[model samples]
Each structure stands twice: as structure tokens, then as C-alpha cells.
Target: MSILSLENVKYSFENTNILNGIDLKISKGDCVSIIGTSGSGKSTLLKLCSDLISPTSGSISFYEKDYNSYEPINLRKQISYCVQIPYLFGDTVYQNLSYPFKIRKQEVNKDKIIKFMKKLNLDESYLEKGINSLSGGEKQRVALIRNLLYKPEILLLDEVTSGLDSQNAKIVQDLIKDLNEDGVTVMWITHSLEQSESIFNKRIQIEQGKIVKEEILK
Candidate 1:
């Protein structure tokens, strides 16, 4: 069975239809790149998949069960969603990163976090830096590292590398490729076709809130 399935899902905002009948089945370890023009409902679709918003019509199933069947907190833990402009809380970067462990009652693994930071070109001292002092790219990297602390079954990203430079973007892409190889299902929305073609095995094109094309890439 597919890890996640969307059957004729639709969403609307104030009587304006944002997504109309989207059907998708994402299998385990599938790294799908979602691309489309602006206002084509790409982000909205990710939000629905993440259970951040309810679908107006049709159903979404996770692990063969109804998506809403699980508690919100538990569901969100398994299906991680990272938006382009992430929201980081607390004073220091350490606080933001440690919350995941705190909620799970697991001890904060500073060594692991530091390792991840090193991979992202962030040094150990970054843990003590204030969130406000970091640039947009830095904040995005920290938020991503925090989400990966628990290694969710699925990763839903929306233009996560948009604010980064070419090198940083490549770093993020490489990390995602490694995670997908490790068996994490990924659905990433991006405007850069070049980037999408390079990292994803499947490409989905959306237009006016509906899927226009879905292709398996080489």
C-alpha cells in the first residue's frame, strides 16, 4: 500500500477553490518534486498532506488509515512540514532545537545536533547565537535540523532552499537526497525546475490547483 494516498482531495478558501480534486499516491522512499506557477495551490497541497489544514472534500490516508484518525500531535510528528519562511521560537538556537526532544521526553542529543550543524556548515558555537541575529538562510537551516532530530516518516518541504545561496541550496539538496535514501518519503515544492530535475525521481506539475502532469524522472 502507498505510504500516503490522496483521493480526489479538494480545498477552498473563502469560497475560492484553492485545490480541485487532487489524487496522488506517494510510496515509501519516493522523493517527489512538486512544481507549478505561483498560485497553483502547491503550498496548499503540502499543508493538506501535513494535516495542518483539513480538506474540504475527499480523503487523505496515511499508512492505510484515515489521516485524521491519529491525534494531531502524533500525526504531525510522523509527517514533518517545513515551510519556506520557517518560524523559529525561543532566544537561542539551542532552545529551538531542544524542543523536539523535550516534547518527546528524550534527552537532547547535543552531539548529534552538532554533527548535523557541521554538515550544514554551521559550527558548534551557533547553538548559543540568538535567533534574531541569524540571517534568513541560517534560520532555515536551523529549522530544518530541528525537524530532522526525530527523523519523521515523511518530509513535506515548500521552497525550503529559496532563501539560500547556490552552495547552501546544494547542501540542503544533498542532505535531502541522503535522507530519502535512508527511507524517508519526501514531497518538496519548488519553482526551480533545474533543482527539481536534479534531486527528485518523480515530478508533478500543478496548474490552477489541479495536477496537470505527473512523470517519473530518470
Candidate 2:
């Protein structure tokens, strides 16, 4: 089943075009890896799909309906984006985890939160710890957990491990792999060739605002 489809999608900033005449389809539960050099428009495509930015031309549809048909807030809940840098707003981990819940007007599921932290090898005590006090890896994991806890139908990852140390990068990498295996549809913008070949079944290569090549890994 196709969950996302972009038809003749184009985006531009000022007079510079970022994406042009792009057409693609992402299936349900697909793990897609988007690869390209910096400024090749890979991230722009992800943002377009996530509705962070709209296309200058063409259309995007989700779940067989126009993406614009869904409310922005609710659409984000179903299709969440995790940028390269971790953005944690709260003073404490507890507050961060509660953010998703608060937005949905629902109570935080403490049991699920604890389980999620444990999966990331985080100590329970860290829940009360300040976000500013957490290490890079810890903050990344918390940011990831917050989005996952939002229960998004699709996940858009934008080079999330690029800024982390080897060990920290592995943690985020493994978490994403695990999530994909567990049936989440993931579109990851990554620079790692090994990761593209190993984790993703489909790969999209972009160049100068166009999808120049596409391959299905065996």
C-alpha cells in the first residue's frame, strides 16, 4: 500500500530551485534511504513529505488523500520529522517526554516512557535530569523517543547521527533500524553508504533538485 506519493513536486527558495519535477511513491512500512551530496535537495524532499515546507508546484498525498487535506498539527502527529540536531525544549527529561502527550491532550504513558528509555539504555533517574545536562547521545535519544512516543505513522529522519560520536551514532542508528524492523515506515536522509545498503530496501539518489537514480536493494 502506498502511504506517500509526490507528483511533479517542485520547491524553490528565492530564485534558486531546490527540487524540480520530482515524482515518487513510498509504500507503507517501507524503509527508504535518500542519499546525495550536501545541497542536493535530499533533505528538501523529506521536508516536503513531512509538510515542513510546501512545494512550489505539484502535489503530495498521504494515505491516498491530499496531504493538505489533513490538519497540520494532526498530520505531524502521523508523520513526524527528526532533524539532524536534537531539539529538546523542556528543562527536564520528564517534561520532554510529556510534550507529545500534552499536545495531544493526553496523559503521558509513564510505563511506555520507561520502557522506551530502557531500550535506549537510559537510566530511570535520568528522567528528572535536565536536558541541558545530558550528553549529546542522551539528548538525541530523548528527542527520538519523544517522536516515537507521539506514535507517528511515518518517520522522517534527517542525518540524525551525523553529529554524534561513533558510540552515540551507533545508538541512534540501531534505534532507527529496530524501529523499521518493528514495522514503522521510515524515510531516512543519510550519508552512510553502508547504512543505505544494510538497512534500507529502497534507495533514492537526488542531484540538483531531481531524482536522478533509484534502486531497490536485494
Report the lDDT tens digits of candidate 1 across residue range 1-218. 79999999999999999999999999999999999999999999999999999999999999989987889999999999999998999899999989899999999999999999998989999999999999999999999999998899999999999989999999999999999999999999999989889878899999999999999996
Top model number, TM-score: 1
Tell me, by lDDT, which candidate is best: 1
Each model's number of backbone clashes? 0, 0
Give the total clashing residue pairs for model 2. 0
lDDT of every model, 2 decimals = 0.94, 0.87
Off by over 4 Å in 2: none
lDDT of 1 at 29: 91
- Which pairs clash in model 2? none
